[model samples]
Target: MNHTLAWRLVSGVKINHLCTPRIAIPSKAVTGSQQVREFSTSYKRSTVMPAWVIDKYGSNEVLRLNNNTEFPIIHYPNEVIVKINATSLNPIDVNMRNGYGSASLNMSRDPLNVKTTGCEFPLVLGRDLSGVVMECGLNVRYFKPGDQVWGAVPPWKQGTLAEFVVASGNEISMKPKSLSHTEAASLPYVTLTAWAALVNSCRLNKQKCPGKRILIIGASGGVGTAAIQLLKAWGGHVTAVCSEDAFSLIKDIGADEVIDYKAEKLEEQLKSKQPFDVILDNVGGTTEKLALQFLKPWSGATYVTLVTPFLYNNDRLGIADGMMRTGVTLSSKVVKHLCKGVHYRWGFFSPSGQSLDEIGLLVENGQIRPVIDEIFPFSEVPKAFSKVEKGHARGKTVIRVTESSK
Candidate 1:
């Protein structure tokens, strides 16, 4: 396995509060027809907009703020154009900036290989955004012009590090009225990732979560923090593993127990919390091997890890051979762990507006909150990338993309 790739993928995959007034959307009295009429008359479509883009992937130095990046358009009737207000950085953003996951992402960008090589140049890198609907495609029904929204853009699409972005209607939902654009921007990517791992892969939800014990490895980062609040809201017993310095933050977010991964007897510490119903591994490498040992045997216990070699394998080998290798490796691990009476599964970031809709309810009800570590101006995107690249982040690194986001 490529250790660097594995670590970077896991670390990069992994929030805050703001006092600014909520940006409200138009009332329901302004129906979709009215919204359409208003948009058609007032919205002057632009051919280009300011954006932070990369002509080539390498490091922070490669990022260029271009004032003439082509404006994104709605190709499908289900798509809508959003004027971005705020955005946030994930580990994936940092890794993508450094050329990680290029092979698979490039394939996704042009599945038929119709586009020439290097066509993905001048690409955008942000994954999460909180913005307002500027224009909607004809078939869009649930949202309209002036609606506020938040969602995670899939890695294959152009990202949110721009003045405006285009996303599918199914990829976004109503933003929480309680949080500012900056705070709302911090949750989507990481929260959706955590939701996929726990609720999708592990099959834990509010109904299934109560009385269940869940363990989160690398529990102070973006995904870890989100996972803690989610589990707690569902009444699960959450044990968070992170550096000792992050213990307070972990506890403040409702972690039932906190274990310092750097403790002298790390394995012993984990053993004491044995028989966990689900183990969410955010830090890959040796932690992947060590974590499975704590799951309960033969009780539908599962070990779901977000750090898989799927993208790495594809990047190193071509898609065909890489997928075959990844399948064989995952099958072997699953079978081996099944023999030990536990199930092993690889968790991935799944884009789900439905999940965000439910999570938005949670936020409005005060069951979940954004955990932001730092915020940078749009001009300092490179600096934000550098901060995430250094790691040890308490929560998330955010970017205020528009002045009005303040």
Candidate 2:
């Protein structure tokens, strides 16, 4: 199995968990009127969760399935253990498989860089997950055992690829009731990217959002689809760029204008539209450069891209030179774009339970909907990662982690 074993998060998860034990099943978390016993770590973690892990980074060839993988545990206050129901795949997971961030992985070993460190082998990798909370730390307040939740974990830690993963309370929220675990698992990573790019970087929050015009490139992918829905929720005019086949789904999600990337010259379409307040780009390099023509100049229009740190150089040049060169190259681009009154920044996903709560509200109110491309059984994870690596998925690809029905 690989990236798509129905995947899922860590920190103020408000969850981390291990193998499942058959216990008295409660439909929901223990609340005010319900009488339930709290979980203790000493309780048998007799079950071993299976996981797909890598001892050393490489391509898909390095992944090994270990059915006896130790169940995850919680040693920190504010932590909760989660039994992952499903997870999804993204480009980052594929890159990590090929050792794309080996330098950062090595550097994280320094004690001073605690925030940047990832787990040591046998390391599991999956960014986001939706699951049930099995146990809550002694100091944890917001959630309790039996709570259904979802969140994204930092890439530097052991991932949600196993039967369980630990997360802090601040990193997760109760999963939206409208979404099944498979549907909820498709969120997190891409939705967080959309939030970072649009809300955090472009300043499209509630107060400043009416009537703003935004353009989303690669609008058919997961991030693009999420960006479109979020932009609509903020009352912005959305123009989506995708293939003709994707137009229906894009339009259904509330895009004001949908441009077929294949049928039209994108630059020509932008020129006709005049200017946009923000351009949230999923494709980078040349496509990103060309799209600069449409920014609403003098208004300090922002251009945010989900691609950054330009890994191509890392592969061509060695690590140190590649890093130095990336810094110089990025600085040049930032300066050039800044002078034209456009702010350019890279988008990175940061998990926030607060943000998840807001998104859940949106989901409950029917403001946004999850877009799933395909679902692979847990055992077929390598095929799922390959699909993401090929970069042709229509929306998000999900994995079914357990054989049981939701």
Candidate 3:
């Protein structure tokens, strides 16, 4: 008699399989009735895998590393499994882990309304990856086994923390030939976000780009650094803002003027050089107000932010009441922008093959360079997130998922 395999996924969860050796019995000694009883109550084995999971979300301490979790397998026809070589972190991952956006995340994970979304245990977390395809589904058209690719996985899907992850064919593109696995890993999510914000949202592409005055706040971080290169590539005049420690770096990369954000009376200094046609803000809180002081008026000035509570509401006061509060706060900001005649837009990271393809081309052609701070092995994922949370990283912090990737 053969053992039956049972699948336990309602929406999308990891289900794994492993083999066990069967014990042989003496054929003459065992009778027909004995065989029936033994087959009905045979010993079953548990197959396990390695993964990082958090039961209830809170701080880093809440995360648990387990070696007995189920492995990731192909769940959809359009998906392909990648043998992940490297992965990187984003602020959105931190937000999701801390329950800041539980309500909406729940809706995305549990689209069928099973009420088991936020409650799903052992949830894997990671977004960007650089790796080789291991298997392809029947409907996958763009890639096959052994092809090196990179892309950002959607938040609702199972993430890239494991050794292998499944992503849609449209979510990835070939990795840049000029970058290493670690260097390639650092670019996708941040690169995609930067390209989308400057090109797609703010219309900073080549046609509208030449000679426009642009201000970039938090210019030492990943998104800010990428934005500086894109703006310079499009021929925009760039002014970068950062602490005194980062001024030299921002300038070497191509900032026409670098301002120390920590300097006393910073607003007055920006006001001194007023009328910026565009503002790309990575630092939130008071950013919208500060940028308006320098934004060009009645001349197509635009303000875009990547960090905002635009989707995640402060839901401590019950979902309905919290939504009402969020509505009032959001409306107030929009009205302020309307009064100022400056276009305010909030940008979010979307999995885009077209954007990734464009960015890969830039890297290949030496148009943009990746600024990486540190490379930690997979064993140090918790430490990586902690480094990012300090809000002072000079560049991106990346994770080398495989031991031999270095």
Candidate 4:
């Protein structure tokens, strides 16, 4: 295992490093009788939990299964504790493991720094989770114990790779009864990203979707797959761009038209179609700008990228006077011309319960299908991640964390 150091800022989390001998789980970080009860339960339980933990940051080889105490049951009034049944590996997880992506690197290096500097080492990785609610915080009213739930959580407080994780109750939604935990786990990050990009960031109105044309780059990715279906649901005509190998898969996922990005020139192929009303660009690089050339003038377009702005030269200036002046001027101009009346939304998907509810409804109704590529046993997280890092994964890759009966 190639262990390397990284840093992260954990809100209220003081440990620079967590080691064995089970550090006395803080009794009560907050004062209150309810708080004491909430925290006491975590230590009261005697079951040792299994987790794929990373002693240091690196690749899949660094992931090691360890028996650790159950996560502290302590919850803020707004928090919820989940007994994770299944979890999905996003590109963010892999990027975090390799200590590569801007988000991952920043999160690890500055656990207390919210400004995204770099990520920390020994970060247990996993983003989207589908599980059962084992405990609810004192102030949590949205959820109750025994509720089947699924959703994303703040990347910093990662215990999902283990038997339990604590998250804001508002970040969870009732898991759709129609799908299994594994299937639901696969949807959170992708669906949340799609929801934020298309609905929140892109401002895609359902009423405006009828007969409108939209282009989705990297249409076979997790977010791309979700985008194609959501756009189609809104009654928009979707033009999907993907490698030749994934062409049929994209088409099956409801893309009205498919572009073989490898075979033909993107702009040239899209020229005949003229300006599209909106474009969702998952792949940055020249592909993003080239797709912009096909956007219709004054037609209300938006370009959304999962990749961070700094990586894509988004020109974000810090609070400093010098950076403010220069960054603001350039950023405004770039957004203006990116598309004719087009909005540029550089997005980082937030965990939300409401969004997950919407996605669950869509899946329960069969408006969207869970595209599962592979399922790995709990011990095979490394193999699952290796497949994801290769970038050839067909759809979502799932890891079974625990059996339901347990």
Candidate 5:
């Protein structure tokens, strides 16, 4: 009887044609079981993936594509693995490639100095990503396998220039249904930085933004362009300062007025539009002092700049001394500006999925659109880097990681 049953199972004969087996298994059951096993096996077998990494920071030539980069795994329950479909370059990425913030970043990575020096080698260096969740940890409640999402990877974390990246649940949100992966990838890092400045630092919002005059210095770049659209969406009057070549692009994104930063008597042009409620300075150096002169004194007006020397100081000095110097500098500047009857702030990027959720709504409603200056295939990442390094982008430079990013 056992021999007959085994033969029937192996030969695919009907159960009735042979003696009954001790345990019955249907054809559908067999297929379902195999499918489950295959799924688990495939997920486990992806132990390594492809990525762009730098063993030592330098110029673009330092970037090397490795096919066997270790696949990131969720070390914490709140972490999720995203399969990157698209990513975009930011100025920070370029700076990081040249070892801009290594000192501070390394300290954050291993606070106790337990790791040896140069442990941050083979660092991946892209900040923004739009992709699908391949796996979620047990503690992740909002996302599951196959959910499309977009987020800015914090500079301290491993970046998105890889096939797979691990991000905390709080760092990402649902991707806007209206945007392709490539388009969505362009906004996160820039938009989040703008949000940190406008909403968090300056306390401007949809309710408060109406009729407020906001000045954006160096307004043709990624953060500047993103700021313009965010302010416009909230009903703010935007004055963008960029080169004459970027005027049309600036205006197209809803800047109410445009000023050429290179024009003769640039201060005169800015003075004519004095008493701006908020000033966002993307250009550092003398512009900070010059732009502050235009803010409305004693009216809760604020000047927020993204060009602070926090990272550079940390990179030059050790973390403790660097932070001390930064604190002293920032405090002195604040006091100096406070006496002038205006608020002064240094804006830094803060990753918030909730903020992305709000921006996603704006994107879906057509209140904001991505300003993509150029798109490059994954193979041409070096060319893309060179394009950004040239320093005259009208908007964000995007990289299409997957052919199906659209």
Candidate 6:
């Protein structure tokens, strides 16, 4: 009888077969026996979904949304999958589309590849996203599925211009309760830049910020707008340089002083205001040199340049690293500090979920608000990118990718 049963089991009839090395096939007389086959339910795998994608580095014409179908799938233990609600455009995106930066446009390639294939074309472009958490990786502890979140994606990973995006657990924070998806979508990159510049680089604490005179060059831009609010909220007096058209907008956002750079020479205007303690110079050109003139002695002012000045030689100006070690000796007299009171610095934004969360709280409490200049549908993403490239937008340009209510 046992031989007959074993023969039937190994004959591949119905569901009868080896269960595994540890578990044996049951006989028909088993208590839970049924007419159908039985399989192990203990080790079921997780499911994955698709995303829109791009493959090559080129213009907007090169973007093909049919790829990245499985984009939000977790490839790393610290990843969290999000259903992108909306994404905003940035100048970096344009550079990325043009294959200007390190991001890929198509097939993934190793950095060591002899050819340019390492960049991988058909890459996703949008960096900042407002979305809902659809899934979380096993190691993700700060967030769970169904949470409303928004923040920047890791620089080299798949971006947020698709239906789904995967971000490191530390790359996102909870969405501000006061902001709609459209409003929150405009913030991440720009606000993070402002935060890093003001808090991390400048090290302006709220107590120390009171009564300090600060000037923001290019005050009407995305980063500038956020800086204006942050500076003012911390009790610093802010002076902004902008075009005539954006003067009122800058003032409305809490700028105590405004300069229309297009209408007048920057130095002539600032000479009337004397030296500033901090100059957050965003524009490069004559404006940069003018900002350097307004720094108070012993007061450190930072000039964050978008355009690197290759023509200006720091070595020739006696501003190199070696110059600092040997204190300036004039006529055998030691000069501890220079009279032209200002410090120069270059800054870039780094991704951080904790910083994003703090900024979100400020936004929720009305301490700051994202300046949203335009909202475009996902299908119109190309047009949005063009708008950002024009460099005239007063605030941020966003792309609505998914239904926010969902």
Of 1 and 4, the candidate ahead on TM-score is 1
- Residue 258, model 6: lDDT of 91
**Comparing 2 and 6 by TM-score, which wins?**
2
Sort every candidate by lDDT, greatest first.
Answer: 5, 1, 2, 3, 4, 6
Over 132-168, each residue of candidate 5 has an lDDT whose tens digit, in order, gives 9876655678887778999998998999888889998
Error of 2 at 46 (Å): 3.3
lDDT of predicted model 2: 0.80
The sequence of per-residue lDDT tens digits that candidate 4 reaches over residues 68-157 is 644545446677778899988888787666644434334344646765322343456788888987656556666777789998876666
Estimate TM-scores for all models. 0.89, 0.85, 0.84, 0.81, 0.89, 0.77
Q: Taking the tens digit of each residue's C-alpha lDDT, what string does model 6 give over 1-406?
A: 1211211221122323322221234546556443322221111112223334567666778766563254345656677778888888887788767665342222123444456544454567788988897656556777877789999975567788887777988999999888887888899988888887777767786777999888899889898998899888889999998999998899899999898877877678888996777777677667766677677766565545554422122222333432332233221221222334445565566788999988887787787987889888887777887788889779999888866623
The number of residue pairs in model 3 that clash at the backbone is 0
* lDDT, candidate 1, 82-114, per-residue tens: 999999999999888888889999999999999
Q: Pairing residues by index, what is the TM-score of model 5?
A: 0.89
lDDT of 4: 0.71
| Clash pairs for candidate 5 | none
Question: In angstroms, what RMSD does candidate 4 have relative to the true structure?
Answer: 8.3
- Superior by lDDT: candidate 3 or candidate 5: 5
Candidate 2, residues 70-166, lDDT tens digits: the string is 8776767788888899999888888888888756655544536454334477888898889998777767778877889989887777888788888
Runs in model 2 lying further than 4 Å from the true structure = 1-47, 109-119, 310-326
Give Cα-based local distance difference scores for all models: 0.86, 0.80, 0.76, 0.71, 0.86, 0.70
Model 2, 253: alpha-carbon shift in Å? 1.0
Report each candidate's C-alpha RMSD, comma-separated, in the order given.
Answer: 11.0, 7.8, 8.0, 8.3, 8.2, 10.4
Worst 10 residues of 3 by lDDT: 34-43
Q: Which stretches of candidate 1 lie over 4 Å from their true place?
A: 1-45
Candidate 3: clashing pairs of residues: none
Candidate 2: minimum summed lDDT over ten consecutive residues — where?
A: 1-10
